[model samples]
Target: MTEFDLIVFGGGTGNRVASAAAEAGMETALIEKGPIGGLCLNRGCNPSKMLIQHATVANRVREASRFGIDASIDDVHFRGFVREVNDELAAVADRKAQDKRDQVNLTLFQEEARFVDDRTIELVESGETHTGEEVVVASGSTPVVPDSIDGIDEVDFLTSADALRLETSPERLVVLGGGYIAAELGYYFDAFGTDVALIDRNETLLHREDADVARAFTEVAEERHDVYTGHSATAVDESNGEFVVTAETEEGGSVEVTGDELLVVLGRRPNTDGVGLDATNIETDDRGFVATDDRLRTSVDGVWAMGDVAGNAMFKHTGDYEGEIVVDNVVHDAGREVDFTALPHAVFTEPQVAAVGRTEAELDKSGTEYVVGRAAFTDTAMSRALKLDRGFVKVLCDLESRAVVGCHVFGHEASILVHEAVPAVRYGLTVDDLANTLLHAHPALSKLVQKACADAVDAADRTTE
Candidate 1:
């Protein structure tokens, strides 16, 4: 049996933790089942954004006629686009792996790891036993494929993993989920001249978002794709070379959608099961996600769980943030706890969506008194100059304390503008505090946020008067 100061179960975010431990003078080992760089770099965010950016260029030129510019997308060369992103990501993974292998104090185990006991693991491929004084599981997550849909088992379908790797855009693409992944890739293909259809059980495309924002996005999405909301996919079948999906409509009738390819973005499951969690004292919730304290330490002593496996937050930025906390607490013995008071989420689809802090539904469910404010992008000089037709910025603040609790945006660069709301939400700035303190340049998207906040404040002042 080989022993190390620390053994990490994944090389994805574990790469960061392992490197930090080694730098802090502890010998570390990182075991990975897949390639280095993990989901975010290889499959999820980076590569998806790469394709999305190209599609954005195509979409911009296609819409440029609105600005009186003669612009058109002659050819997408989609196969070359996929190849470029994939090859670049692969090179990145290779470089990171080689760098880890070169580290004197960090050993890279290019294999799967399963728990032997509470403090030990077996490298599955080599049958090697390894022990650690401290252990961390950053194994991340995998796409969820349900077997409930009849005939789905036999048909060839693509998930987000496969969608990002396609060299050729399908003649017609059918998407199975209405969340961020489905919205993003569905829009991307639509921009590239591929016929796209979206079928979702939810009534809105981004069901988690506020009703107005969700409605706005669905409206925009409908303009570009065949959107079948409130439809649940029941089964998949193939006729000739095309794929057919039978779904149950909201009104209880059956409908069929035919497409050249099917892309499933229903959801993701944590990579906790089959990881030997049963062998350890590590407790998991009903969803198989590791149950961790605020500090991110697993129930097992000297063990920590983070990223998707821990079920705290699923974003890449969340993983990196928690990884830093884990490194500080374990390596430096800092005793730092995670406070996700202002974590932000963004979907990079056209007319991007972003949100920070508690959603209005949560506030209503809790019976929390709040203020609502809204501003449309069309009211802004910049949006008018750009001839942008849609988008809104909204803010909610506590009625008594005047603290801004939530903010949501739907517009161009909404992802970037959402960050401005983060500090206000995190630090508990009031509507008046934000509206009065911040200086937004004229004709800039930043002013939209201040306008929303000022709207709320003005409404409150009127009520008082």
Candidate 2:
């Protein structure tokens, strides 16, 4: 038994927590069963975004005629492009993992860790065990493949992780689900000249986002791809080396679609079970997510959990914040709690969608008094000059405090533009504060933010008068 001050399970965000402990002169050990950077750096966001960037460039070249440019795409060379991006990102994650292993007074266990008791975990490597104290579980999540669909197992299927590593592009690809992953990959394949058919149970794509934004997104995608909504996939089968998907329509009609491959982006399940939590005092919710308090502490004493396993917001940024909160409580003796208010999220589609804080629908459901102001990118000078007029920014403000309650954007660089409003909403900055600030460089995308704030203030003043 080699006891330590902290032993973190899962190397993704757990590495951050372990570093904090070791930096505080506490003995820390990190146990990982997979790559060091976890899903975000290894398979999820980083690699996906890298491929998306390549697709973006390819798209620009393909449509260069619209801009009066004679640029032509001789060859997509998707395999080589994907290989370069994944290989480069994997190298970076590996280097960071190694640096953490060497820089701190922490031992790295390249094996699975199971909780043996409330305050101890047994690191298992090839059926051998090593003991530790003060354990932290951050073992992330995996793509969920539902077992109800008939013949789903007959044909070869790909999840986002496996799809990212694909060297060959299928001639016809069928994507199930309308979430961010499906939308992104669907768009990428369509841009790469692969015939894509997107099937979803819901009537619109991106059901989690604002309805108008979802409609706009689906409209753009439909222009170049096949979209089937309000239909349920009843079964999937293979016919002569092709996948045949049978879907029952909302009106009780049957529809059959066929493709070369199927990509299931339905959802993800937390990777909490089978880690020997049943043998310890750690409690998991009915959904199999690890239960944690406001301080991110598990039911078991001296044991904490974060990231996908913690079961709050499943974003990487949220996981990073949780890591910091756990450090504050465990090391600095601070009772600092994690506040999820004003958390930002984005979907990197053609017309990007970025959102922070509350939505109008949420406010309406809660019967809260709030006002919304919207400005279209089409109305902006920069958007006109660039011929990019696909989305808008809508701001929600509290009626009493006149402070920014929420901000949602759908358009070019929405992900980058949304960050400016994050601090404003997090700190409860008033619309007047934003209106008075001198934003730099006219005819820029950021001017849209400034103008939106000014318009919000103007509307508020009119209502008062």
Candidate 3:
């Protein structure tokens, strides 16, 4: 038996927590079954974004003639682009993983770890039992391939994970689901000159966003691909090397959609079952997510869980925050609670959508009195000069306190622009504070954020008068 002060299962963000513990002079060990950087760095966010950037640049060149620039793209060369991006991202993740392994005085086990008892885990590689004074589980989630649809097992399909490693572009692609993954990949394939058909059960895509924002994105999506909303996929079958997707709409009409390949992006399920949780006293929710309190502590003593496995927010940024919270509580003995309020998220679509804090519907449901300020990018001098049209920024603020309650943006570089408002909302900065703040560079996209804030203050004043 190998005894340590702490042992963390799953490398992802758990690597950070284990490193923090080891730096504090605690004996620690990290166990990872897959690549050390986990899904986000290796397969999910980093690689996907790199591929999307290629498509974006290609699209820009294709439309360069609109700006009186005669730029012609000879070929997309998608396979070459994907290979380069994947290789670069994998190298970075590998280096970071190795650095963590080298710096910390911790044992790195490249094998599956199963909980043997309340405070012990068995590393399957050496069949060694390691007991820790404290344990942290950060095992992440995997894509969910629903069992309800028939013939899906026989048909050739791709998940976001597989799509990232595609060697050749499909002549026609069918994507199922309305989430960010589906939208992004569908857009990517379409921009690469593939015929894309996107199907979702919801009435509008990105249903979690504001209605107006969702509508604007859907319009952009429809321009390049066939978008079928309010339709549920009933079955998927293969015919002569092609996939046939049968869907029934809310109106009770049957529609058949076919393509060279199908990519399902329904959702992800937490990787919690059969990993020895049943052998221990660890508690899990009905959906198999490890149950944890605000402090990221599991039900059992001397054990904690974070990231996708803990069933908090599933985003990569959320996982990073959870890792920090766990480290603070375990190391510094700080009992800081997790605050999800004003947490930010962005969807990397054509017209990128970024949001922080509450939505109009959420505020209305809570009966919070608020005022809204909105400004269109099309109204800006920069937008006119660049001939970029589509999307706007809307700011919501509390009427009484004048504090910014929420900020939502959809348009060029919206993801980057939303970072400016994060501090304002997080620190309860009032609309007056934003309006009076100095904004540099008149032609920059940031001016739109400033304009939106000023417009919001002006709207509040009119309502009061």
Q: Which residue pairs show collisions in model 3?
A: none
Task: Give one digit per residue, the lDDT tens place, for model 3 in 1-465.
Answer: 989998888888888888899899889988888888898988798988888888888888988999999998887788888899888887887886787778757888878878888888898878999998989989899988888888878777898999999979889999989888998888788778889998999988888887777888888888888999888898999888889999888789888999988999998988888578888888999888999998988999889999999988889999999988999998788998998877889988778999898888888999998898888989988888878878799899888888898989999888988887888899999888887888557778887777788888988888778
- For each candidate in turn, the TM-score is 0.98, 0.95, 0.95
Model 3 lDDT-worst window of ten: 96-105
Per-residue alpha-carbon lDDT of model 1 for 164-212, expressed as tens digits?
9988888899999999999999878887889999999999999999877
Top lDDT prediction, candidate number: 1
The better-scoring model by TM-score among 1 and 3 is 1
RMSD of each: 1.2, 1.9, 1.8
Candidate 1 worst ten-residue window by lDDT? 456-465
The Cα error of candidate 3 at residue 213, in Å, is 0.7
lDDT of each: 0.90, 0.84, 0.87
How many residue pairs clash in each candidate at the backbone level? Answer: 0, 0, 0
Which parts of model 2 are misplaced by more than 4 Å? Answer: 461-465
Look at candidate 1 and give me any clashing residue pairs.
none
Over the stretch 219-315, how does candidate 2's per-residue lDDT look in tens digits?
A: 8878877889887788999878788888888789888988988899999888877677888888999989999999888887788889999889889
